[model samples]
Target: MKNPCIRVLATGGTIAGKAGSATRHDYRPGQIGIDDLLSEAESLGMAVTLSGVQIANIGSEDIGPAVWSPLHAATVAAVADPAVDGVIITHGTDTVEETALLLDLTLPTAKPVVMVGAMRPADAVGSDGLRNLANAVRVASDPGAAGRGVLVVMGDRVFAARDVRKVRTRGTDAFRGFPRESIGLVTPSALDWFGAPWRMGEAARFVWPDQWPEVPVLPIWAGIEPDYVTRLTGPDTRGVVVAGVGEGNMPEPVRQVLRELAVRGVAVVRASRIDEGLVDREPEDDANGFLAARALNPPKARILLQLMLASGVSVRAAMQAEFDRR
Candidate 1:
């Protein structure tokens, strides 16, 4: 491909952060603008033409429907444009997994959409943002990446949005794939293959809603009171995902509340607190009218459940089938 045109959608993160000094521990996120960030990435000279679009300049911790809705619209537009070959999203590492998974669930475009972020601020002495941004552009411009769904490029590894997670609180290689390895690897001059791309396309697509539904992730801890769970459910509560103990097991009292909620037409998904494992449905789960989260962690399950509820997909079996898609 000759000078593949890649559109960079910048949502402020550490990748755009500004600090007092190169080694300072404290810094302001999104202090740098998209033009400056993209200019730095372009300076790396990766042979790709770049265009910039600033979606938001706040940290990813504040990312919600407000940011996601517009970002989703911009991504859809970019993928549909004949002149645009691919898309790159510069997002905060803190919540990149959630955003990436949300985009993967909603978008069905054949063009590559790659998200990137950094562990250190853009102005830091050893910042990884520019390299990640450049690698994201490379992945987006690669024809082989077209049908890989949404991807997160970090630490020189390309992770499927569905499988990526932040494993460490701080570090350049904080992200990792759960229940699977990275789909591919990339450096400045080379790309290596691994697992096959796992893009579901229309089969897993969820229409971006005008307003996202209310779905909260509640963690089940020892001695947790039932009122805590009750407080989270109300007139507007569409669904809940409990990050239960091993195999998604919770104390009897909490389980009872969830069962009642499930019977009352509120969707309940039992996701595990364990870092990486399956929460397969069991006979007891069927008897309690609960759905298992399978391989989805609590946060990812929350996003998926939110999309399902917003799309008017409340049937228990249907929702369970969505979880079983892996």
Candidate 2:
């Protein structure tokens, strides 16, 4: 059988970072380029033809619509190419989940799209970038990986994009899949599957606007004020996601503000700030005109809301169905 061909899209992150000293704490992200990363991956002797494109050279924290627009277009185009069997994205771990979720929502291909990142700098002792990159290529080449939407490969664990989140700041085991175990695991010999495949709604191509709608995420904390909610009522503010306390609860004052925003046609979504759990609809939430985000974290919920609003879909019904999907 012919070896699968993979196109790697590299975005700057720790995997491409370079520290001045191996024992130093400070390092510069994106100092290394995609060509070098791929060259190292090739040394692993994986049975695949690897190619790379430099999408961006910055940490994930700097990732936004400017990067997302082109990245999405590039990914869609790459997967559509007959020569490319799968796509792999090298991203920074800081916000890798957000990027993965965005791609998962947008990409329509059955071919694999795997996102890989490293917690340590490329030049650091025991750096994991090469191994993670090799594992990502392996997963992408596997036929079983098709139809699984976007998968995040880190520390030998494969997580569905929708369920994966960065849990730690500095560790090889920085990502975790919530509400359940990882869908697959990467071994030295092959990728192993232990869970059923899952995917989001069919890809809906979106035209990149000059500016994406301004949707802000507000966290609920003790003594939180409703002043910020009022600011979100500005014309430029299209939507808001409340990272509320347990079970997606917000203060009464903030709830009132959200009700006001909803009355004015601004979409409001309720998501838990906690790592894992379901946000079911409650009477008060309904009365306040808030949509429950179900199992989605605040950041992911924000992305979904942005896409739904941008596509002219009914936010309430769409979000409810997304959460209720099997």
Candidate 3:
């Protein structure tokens, strides 16, 4: 039988970064290209036949709709290809979770789509990029990796895109699954599973908007001024997500502004700034037409809100149903 073909789409991050010195922290991400990264992976002697496409070579921090639209389309095409068994994405760790979640919600194929990145630069000593790339290939080629939405592989751990978050800024083990344990782990010798497999709806059934709505995440702190909320509200603002403190609670002033925004037809979702927890609506929240983010973090909640608004669904109703499913 022919080896399964894995198409790696590279959207550069620290995994492709280059530093002046091995010990130096300053470096430019995406200095290396997709071909180079794939060569490193190939050196690992994985059984699968690997090919690559360079989607972008910019840091994940710069990622937005312009990049996401094309990336999503390319992913769909790759998964739909008969010869391709799975797909791997090389992304920057900064915003990889957001991109992964976006793909997971829109790309419904059962074929594995594994997202990988490195904490250290590619040229640095003790770089984890090559190993992570190889592990991503292994996961993508595994039949068991299918139907699990999108997965992030880093530091020998496998995280579901929806539940994964970047916890440590500089640690090699930067990514973690929150409000839930990691679904699996990847070792040189074996791939182990520990969580239930889940699937997403068909992409064809959902409409991809020509333009994405502007939804910004606002973090609430103690004694925050109402002007901060006032600045975000306008006709151009389609939705706003508040990264509130402790169970999605915001200052009363901020909450008042959110209610005003809701009255003006702007969708409001309350997500917790805390590392892990559900953000359900409190008594006051219900009266303000606010939607809880459930267990989703601020960034993920922002993505979900954009998607919901794009579909022309009642944002509150859509959000309610999404959390109800959990």
Candidate 4:
């Protein structure tokens, strides 16, 4: 039997970072290349043929539409290839979850799409990049990983993109699934899944946009000035996501500004500032013409709203429907 062919799509993150010294925490991310990283993985001697494809070499914080467009295109092409069995994206931990969500919403889920990253720089003491890379390859090559949407493998846990979040600033255990536990676990010898099989795919995907839309997340807080809300309205602002306090609530002043924006055809979504909870529609939300972001954090909500605006479909209805999903 042939070895499973996995394309290691590299979007540089800490996994590729190089520190001043093994003991030093300060380092520059994206300093190493995909070929170099793959060489480390190849040393493990897994039954897999790894092809390194360099997509971008930037810290995850710099990830935006410029990188997303090409990443999506390359991923789609790799997935469509007859010889490729699965794909792995090595990304930065800071914003890997957002990128994972974006790919999960746009790509076909028939094959495994795994996002892997390291909390520590590749050259640091106790560096975890190789372990994560090996684990990601294991998951990608696994037949069971198919149709489960994009998976983020870190700390030996496999998280579905929709629920994964970067919870800690530094550590081996930086990522977690919110409101839901990890769907599975991975080890050197075995893979185990705990949840019922659920899939996300092109059947429920948004059309990849030619132009990325401008959707900004505005944070709401105690004594938030009205200018903060009012300034968000402009010709280029296609949508606005408010990281509202507690169940997506804001002061009446902020609500009024949002209401006006909603009336002007800008998509307005209220997502929670809290980490792990649903933002359901309050009674006033309907009257104000606002959509609740449900379990989506502010950043993910912004991504979804941008897609909705870019497609120019039934924006209001689509936003509401997706937010309502379990």
Which 10-residue window in model 1 sums to the lowest lDDT?
195-204
**Model 4 ranges off by over 4 Å:** 200-204
CA lDDT of each prediction against the hidden true structure: 0.88, 0.85, 0.86, 0.88
Q: Residues 202-242, candidate 2, lDDT per residue (tens digit)?
A: 45344444556789998889998899777645788888888
**lDDT of candidate 1 at residue 280, scale 0 to 100:** 94
Model 2 local distance difference test score: 0.85
At residue 291, candidate 2 shows an lDDT of 87
Please give the RMSD to the true structure for each candidate, in Å.
1.4, 1.9, 1.6, 1.3
Model 1 global lDDT (CA atoms, 0 to 1) = 0.88
What local lDDT score does residue 61 receive in model 1, on the 0 to 100 scale? 97
**Candidate 1 lDDT over residue span 87-169, tens digit each:** 99999988999999999988985889999999999778898888888788889988778678899999999998888999987
Report clash pairs, candidate 2.
none
**Model 1, 83: alpha-carbon shift in Å?**
0.7
- Model 4 agreement with the true structure over 1-326: per-residue lDDT tens digits: 99999999999989999997999968999999988998899989899999989999989999988999899999998999999999999999999999999998888887899999999998888999999888999999997898888999999999998899988998899888977869999975578988655773445378899887778889987899878876766798888999988988889988898899889888889989888868878788778989999888999888888877877754566679987773
Against the true structure, candidate 4 reaches a TM-score of 0.97
